[model samples]
Target chain A: MNISIKRKDQGDHRFLVAVSGEIDVFTAPELQKGLLPLTEIRGGTLILDLNETRYMDSTALGVIVAALKSASRHQCSFSVTGMTPRIQRLFEITGLMELLKRVQTSRGVAND
Target chain B: METQEDESQLSEYRTLLAHYISQKDQKLPTEESEHLRRQLHACGILPEDLLGLHIEALKGAGIFSESAMMRSLNFLMKMMSGYSKAYREHQELKDWQKQLDTELDIASALQKTLLDGKVPACSFADIGAISEPAKRMSGDYYRIVNDGKRLVVTIADIVGKGIPAAMCMSMIKYAMDSLPENSQGAPSYILSLLNRVVERNVDTNMFITMFYGVYDPETGIFSNSSAGHEPGFYYSAREDRFMDLEARGLSLGLAREAEYKEYARRIYSGDMIFLLTDGVTEIRKDHDFIEREQIVALIRRWMHLPAAEIVKQVMRALKKMQDFSLQDDFTFIAIKF
Candidate 1:
């Protein structure tokens, strides 16, 4: 499966990147590469969109965990948006929901 | 190296990307937008590919604005990476399965070679032997050697099971090969040599039960000795009955100088001699022993059958009694004169 990245401005220091695909061991590195730079910059919030993701495995879970650590180190808040039930359940199984902020849609950031 | 922290960071970042991509008109600060623009560019999707179609899409939607192109690009990069991870995992699983299948094939071939041996011919005897090792390997072996005037026949079963027993059986075959050409002189003499060979090399817990004999096909007379093996059966079509031959020696590998009693039998046409391991009569049926009655019943039915057919029938009956599962290696050898 191929993943696509879309960028958008979410307020003054928050950038949103939407992701869609089946995330697993093969594609996790691509997800990691896309998020590593933003966390390096240390301030902008990254809103990850996973609503279109139909399935994910343990390696995909690893990618998500890596992104969370990078954000915390940079002191930038990380939020998940547009989580489909499948993605939501994965996050629940991995206990990722407990550690990261989650929202129904990226649209809320614009009003803020 | 920083796997733990990197994983945590990746999760946090994905959460934001999830949020960012869903926003229809989200605006990032100028610096943040540029940073995300570069991240998307690194994924091999040019900024224009993400933006070109979205620019028209935004204008047509009426809710579209200048920031639409950047948001679209960021979303596309996340999708590509997610797909890459899935592809790699599928390949890994396929490779692992292939490796497992190859190993299983090699193990099967090695087991077959260790259990089967070449059959030697004798002028006066027509010998037939067969062994089945269930699902895994087992310790059932039979050998026939033509020693000039006498035909030497040996059938043995190693105690215990699996690959270990098969290994010990191989060692025993090698020990037999080392014996003198005229070694069938006496049962006790041969057993003394065999016991010394086994006890010197094998673990104390390992042992073997064997029935060895010499036959003069010209005279139709057989002389034999047993080392803790099951009593053999001699079937006479003329008499229409089966007689049990005594097993008159201690098991091999237990002690040196083990005594064995010699027995002789004269055979006529339509006379049959059968040698069996415990796995035959010891077959379990409804949690009860199959015993001598069932065995005699089977032999009576197939007394006139060919040697192969007789062995096959016994195996079939044993399988039926064990509910189609043969838990041990079942081996038998038969000679007709």
Candidate 2:
């Protein structure tokens, strides 16, 4: 599957990464490469938007967890928004829902 | 220097130079050119100076007039650009290959440890199983649990292959081991418990097809349930016929309230139960899948042998038909009563 990543600077040490398509074995590496660097920025807020993601595997979940860990070590805030029900179910099943911060986006409001 | 003879010689030299340059093939230099340039630099001779001297020689020979010099310079520039682009692409490919190799090594190590679990021993039935992964990791898993009075057999195939499926299989093994002691003998109940665990622990995008069976030697009864797994075949020595042990259930991790129905059958001495993942039956010969009846026939032919030998012979036969390398993970279990 293909994974397209778009990075948006939200000003004041915050970044938004909108990821689309499937995050599977073939595509997780691309996603990891894009998100891991953002987590290293100190005291930054990294938001991952997965509203258009069609699917995610355990490896993808592992990558997300790694990003969260890196963010925590750098004293940065990390959250994921616009999770489809399928992706949300994956997070729940793998017990990663507790580790990852989930944000709700109402209409066109920015994910804070 | 002011001789007409010298001028005529220079003109002749220019004609000769142009003829040679036009006749020789022009090809872009490869990475070896970089090594040559480095060697030149180490020898106190700059590569740019070397090129400048050659250009001057060509100009003095009258082979490189203003337009000709520009054409040669442009060709050199394009050659350098092409070489650098090729070098970068080569390095990127090497890096990607190295990364994939490391990942496969880690995945293979993890899969080896999980697949090497001890097989349970039974007095009345002899069991043997083998799993061969198509890649560095496998999606197929099998476990045997003997609680002295009864034997529980489970064989499952996850949706995908490689590291992700291996991770899921490892989780399934742990979940199966953690089932309640009271739920050991009920095939349907054990599958239900396993389904719940998978639903809670595995990704929804992935699912597992499993066959869970519990055999009681004391009562000569075998109860089995499937979660979208292939139907195994049972050879009845008394009736001299083979029957499929069919059960209805959805694949695990499909839903929270998935239900599995169990089927029970009496076992007789000299009977054989054969179970396998799709890898065995799905073997492609020419363009069509190997017939299920062929698998059943093979089992029947080897029914008299020990379980281990039977499985070995069947695998040998499958390899003969499929050229010794399957496209997916191949797992098979044979139990002789």
Candidate 3:
């Protein structure tokens, strides 16, 4: 998987992370390593772009949920964007849609 | 006090030295040489008078000294040390990979021994089961124990696969063994006990889905309970229809106080119960899953055969449909009456 994190600007604390490729039990740890620290940045916003992600398993969902919990503790705003329909169904079936924030685009500027 | 001709010659020498220093490839003096020359100039020696002596020193021993050669030698030594360090790390990584492979092999063997143990011989039911892991080891488990009167059968699938899931299977095996013999007939009680053991021992992130059933040879009664397991199929020869064996419960280890409900049915001759892990039902086709109805239809096509033959035929069909490589472990158990 490829995970790239880009800060919005010099003064802005918001970060945009784009993830691509499969995220299964074996590869979720790499995603977690890239995402977990962003959750701890106080008062920051994290926008995860999963437009290119073809597949993800339950372990990957767990990693995302863990990041959400950490983001909550640090008062960071976290949202996921551009999920495929199949991926959306998986999130709904696992009942993770209720826990995670979803947005329409990578910018995540629109109000929910 | 120099003569006019000697002073003129010295001025000419200074001009030549300045011109030489301006040339790119002249190999200028190092900072150390400049420092020494400055100290000499401060002590009242003219820079122009020292130019010829400095040139001679540079040619003889200053820039080409033993210390300069030692510096180059030291750099080569450092490069060699770095290479050796990288080589050692590569060898250590290879050794670690070898060690992990061996350990996984041993664990896989032990898991096979536990799973392929003797199945109970009962007149009321003929059972056949198979567990095929997608990787080197499986996370699926099944065991049938005969307690002289009734036979107890249990099948479970851990949420993950490979070594960690195999380890959880081992923990489940021991926990099953430790259950009281009296609890074998009560599926809910058995699952509740197992849930406590799993909740206490297994990692919270992981959970297991299980189906536990007890069969009585004398009465042809099959009582079963489920812990968030997939709903198995029940084919009745008399009714000529398939029924779903559904129960309500949370997956094991999800919650400490989760309760499982029991269901019972009488098995007549030619009746069969088909139990399977999600691996069989959730086969991937492009971006979608192979429909469960397709699997049920495949079972119906071979419903007339014995339990073992039915399992074999269904697995063969699935293998052909999947192009012989499953994405996850495939486990199925069939009980024919």
Highest TM-score against the true fold, candidate: 3
lDDT of 1 by residue, B125-206 (tens): 4566778875466677788778687788788887656666778888988888788767646766776678778757775445
Using DockQ, rank the candidates from best to worst: 3, 2, 1
Report the lDDT tens digits of candidate 3 across residue range B118-237. Answer: 666877778888778888889888888777788888888887778888889999998987776556448998898898988788764577789998888788899999886767888888
Q: TM-score of each model's B chain? A: 0.67, 0.75, 0.72
Better of 1 and 2 by DockQ: 2
Which pairs, if any, clash in model 3? none
The true-versus-predicted C-alpha distance at residue B145 of model 3, in Å, is 2.0
All models: lDDT?
0.66, 0.73, 0.72
User: Model 2 - which docking category?
Assistant: incorrect
Instruction: Give per-residue lDDT, candidate 2, residue B220.
Output: 89
Fraction of reference contacts reproduced per prediction? Answer: 0.00, 0.00, 0.06
* DockQ, each predicted model: 0.01, 0.03, 0.13
What is the C-alpha lDDT profile of model 2 across B294-321, one tens digit per residue?
9988887887788888888998898778
Per-residue lDDT for A1-112 in model 1, tens only? 7777677776777788777876654576787788767755556678788777655543455566556656666666678888776456435522356446432123235335
Worst 10 residues of 1 chain B by lDDT: B53-62
Q: A70 in model 1: Cα distance from truth in Å?
A: 63
Question: Considering every candidate listed, which one attains the maximal lDDT?
Answer: 2
